[model samples]
Target: MPATSHPTRAAVAWRWVALVLALSQLAAPAVTSALAGDFLASGATNRALITPAGYAFGLWGVITVLSAVTAVVIVRYGLGSWWETGILIDICIVFVGFSLWLVIAAQSWLWVSVVVFGVMVGALAHVMRKLIRHRDDLTCPSWAATLATVTFGLYLGWSSIAWFANVAAAFLDEGWSAEGWWWQFVVLVLASVSAIGVTLMLRGTLGYVAGVLWALVAIAVGAAQRGSPVLVSTAAVAAVVVAVVAAVTWQRLGRRARISPATA
Candidate 1:
């Protein structure tokens, strides 16, 4: 029943570095938004924060908050441990990569930015899995990890959709018309399926709910663009699929809880 020792100076210094990096990234959007006056607005040539759908693109806040929490947790628990090292590495790589992607995207390297963002998302997923396995070692608030996992997963899923949207938008802007309406239908089906898969993989009903909200927000933005009915319809379908999946998942989890003992 002895008290644990505090983290070493090195660990504390690393956490401070993480905090600084995270805050810098989080503040970038506000700086750009103020100085450039919608330069990063949706469809703008310098758009880095806003997507084609005009969502505020606040994933940076989520990323920053998570990174800060993770850093604090590592500092308090001593990153000398294997689990702490692994988690710290994951957080650093993913967050730094994501911040770099924002810069690339802002420079109009859309395709390169998309790939980098995808890698960041994959890294986040890996980090979440590792955290879940070592959940007991995490000393932060439960809500911290829960929010981090859910936000990271949903953001990844949504960004995947946005990546395709960016490609499609670029193509359209370049005068490449779709061969037929069928392609739009295909996009809709794929988006819906991807959302459902991501939701299920996260195993959180709130994650699915977040996905649905994101889908709807995307659709609303698409509608605002005076886009084709086909595209709008696709977004609508994706939202519906997310909602239904979330409901089913909630019911299944509820049933399992009911059949089990409260303390078991």
Candidate 2:
């Protein structure tokens, strides 16, 4: 996927849409904070051991920028030449789902927000699964490839971690207790396994691994703060496992990249 000089009218149109999308995402935090007392505060005590630190949410800034960048390059691969029409439609709907989530979340509709996010995540996951499976078949320009990888990977990865927190929030609202150490332990273990499962499935896409790593490490922080060594250790171990797998995968990929096509 070499760089291309031609950015079509369609690319410009996509850029405009991307601009709007970026602006919308930028406003979401402020809008939600004003309407619902900010996401972290809204989580309150029910969020222990699962909520990332206040600094962690800063990652949204990165995603917002990338989302905009995606617009610029999406059709840069020669005006929708690389993407299947269905894939493009799915991408559009996924962003719409993103906007909807912000609205629902702002209203403090926890369960509904969860559902919206689940849909959003599912859509992106579908795209990403297809992408990984058919990367070589993709004819997008270099920039398009990079932008798509970062944008979709981050969206899928972060949302995946957030989904767990969202579910936990709903459970807490329904009379669930953080005091249930046994249940918390079980949940942490399962989340750990799921993160590993995702890593295996993606073959260690860094964006996906990074998101799980962020959530797991942050949860570990919360656990340590609350003096739960068991949860902390589990979180740390899970994070380490993911990191190691990612490293190994990258090495193998590098080796494959080095092999000549004819040799292979």
**Highest lDDT among the candidates is held by which one?**
2
Task: Name the 10 consecutive residues with the lowest summed lDDT in model 1.
Answer: 43-52
Q: Write the residue-wise lDDT of candidate 2 on 1-264 in tens digits.
A: 333344455545554664566557767667767776755565533465565555666777787777766755654442233444545556666777777776776666789978988887777777777667667656665556656876888878777877777777777767787665666777677777877887777878877887778878877887777778888888899899989988898899888878867596
Instruction: List TM-score per model, in order.
Output: 0.72, 0.84
Angstrom error of the Cα, residue 28, model 2: value is 2.1
Residue pairs in collision within model 2: none
Deviating ranges (above 4 Å) for candidate 2: 1-19, 44-46, 75-83, 258-264
Q: Which stretches of candidate 1 lie over 4 Å from their true place?
A: 1-14, 30-52, 55-82, 131-139, 169-175, 178-185, 205-208, 262-264
What lDDT does the true structure give each of the candidates? Answer: 0.57, 0.70
Candidate 1 lDDT, tens digit per residue, 60-125?
466466556655554544433335555555556666776676566566566676577667667766
Per-model root-mean-square deviation over C-alphas: 4.7, 3.3
Please list all clashing residue pairs in model 1, or write none if there are none: none
